[model samples]
Target: MIQQTLTQLRELRLSGMANSLLSQIEQPATYEGLSFEERLQLLTDSEANDRENRKQQRLLKAAKLKLSAHARDIDYQHPRGLKQSVMASLLQCHWINKAQNLLITGPCGSGKTYLACALGETACLQGYSVKYYRISRLMLALTQAKADGSYSKALQNLAKIDCLIIDDWGLEPLTAAQRNDLMEIMDDRHEETSTIIMSQLPTDQWYQSIGDNTLADAILDRLMHNAHRIKLKGESMRKIQSNLTDGEHLE
Candidate 1:
């Protein structure tokens, strides 16, 4: 009878509850003292938690973040000008709810990508969909979509993501086509979704990098209008952690 009930639960797609039930059956003495209502509540909570975990895993896999980072693992001792208060607020993900943008600028190897990925992970945990891209790669994708006649569909899909993380921003000058593609993407996401931009250049220099004054203005207006900024300053974290640093020697 118990095996049949477990089979029924699995068929109904309640694996969490089924597993919980199996555990209870195997250790009857542990749960025998609990009231029926208490046991039922435990099964319900397990199923809900299991569903949430699966959803978060799907989101994280879809995100494809460059780094496997988490908010709890962020290095606050790196002297990179990151503020605990600001990060705490951001982790709550209220800005994402309001469709606000985030700009993270710093020198290369200063943990900008890590921080951005950490926030992206947080957004996933908070039940928001996220996507990460390097500026060059995203431009390549859009160009390919145009050639494949899926440009419109691609833009629509991008517009639906709750949080978009663009890493390596302003790394190269934009071509006219890339500029137009960026304009389309920004226009679609403007005021409707959140974007986190990681750049090595200062915000003021982004205009020059875009290469077209008019398009730069349009893109920046959409991206910066309601954006929060973080500027990190310090030596390269990679250099600091390298085994070949000045005093470190190989035996």
Candidate 2:
């Protein structure tokens, strides 16, 4: 009878409850003291928790973050100008809920990408949809989507994400087509979702990188309005953490 009930629970897709019941059956002494309501509540809680864990895994996989970073794993001792107070507020993900943007600017290897990915992971844990893209790759994807006749659909999908992390911003000058594509994406996401932009150049220099008078103005207006900024300043963390000997440098 117990095996039949377990089979039924699995068929109904209540694997969490089924597993919990199997454990209860194996250790009857542990759960025998509980009332029927108490046992039922435990099964329900286990199923809910299992569902939440599965959802988080799906979100993280779909996010495609470059780094496996978490908010609690951020290194505060790295001396990269990261403030605990600011990170504390950001970790709460209230800005994402408000559809605000985050700009993280710093020298290369200063952990900008890690911090952005960390915040993105936090958003995923909080049940927000996130996607990460390098500026060049995203431009390529947009161009490909245009050629494939799915450009509009791509833009619509991008607009629906709760948090979008754009890494390596301003690495190269933008062409006219890429500029237009960026304009479309930014316009779609403006004031409707959150974005995290990681750049080596400072914000003021982004205008020159965009290389257009009119579109640059429009893009910056939408992107920078009410956005939170984090400017990291320090030596390359990679250099500091390297195990390579100074005398054994590779060409």
Clashes of each: 0, 0
How high is each candidate's TM-score?
0.95, 0.97
| Candidate 2 per-residue C-alpha lDDT over 1-251 given as tens digits, one digit per residue, 9 for 90 to 100 | 99999999999999999999988889999999999999999999988998999999999999999999988889999899999999999999999999999999999999999999999999999999999999999999998999999999999999999999999999998999999999998999999999999999999999999999899999999999979999999999999989999888987
**Per-residue lDDT of 145 in model 1:** 96
Cα error, residue 134 of model 2, in Å, equals 0.6
Tell me how candidate 2 scores on lDDT: 0.95
Q: Write the per-residue lDDT of candidate 1 for residues 1-251, one digit (tens) a residue.
A: 99999999999999999999999999999999999999999999888998999999999999999999989999999898999999999999999999999999999999999999999999999899999999999999999999999999999999999999999999988889999999998999999999999999999999999999999999999999999999999999998978786666655
Q: Which candidate is the best by TM-score?
A: 2
Q: What overall lDDT, based on C-alpha atoms, would model 1 receive against the true structure?
A: 0.94
List RMSD in Å for every model shown: 1.8, 1.1
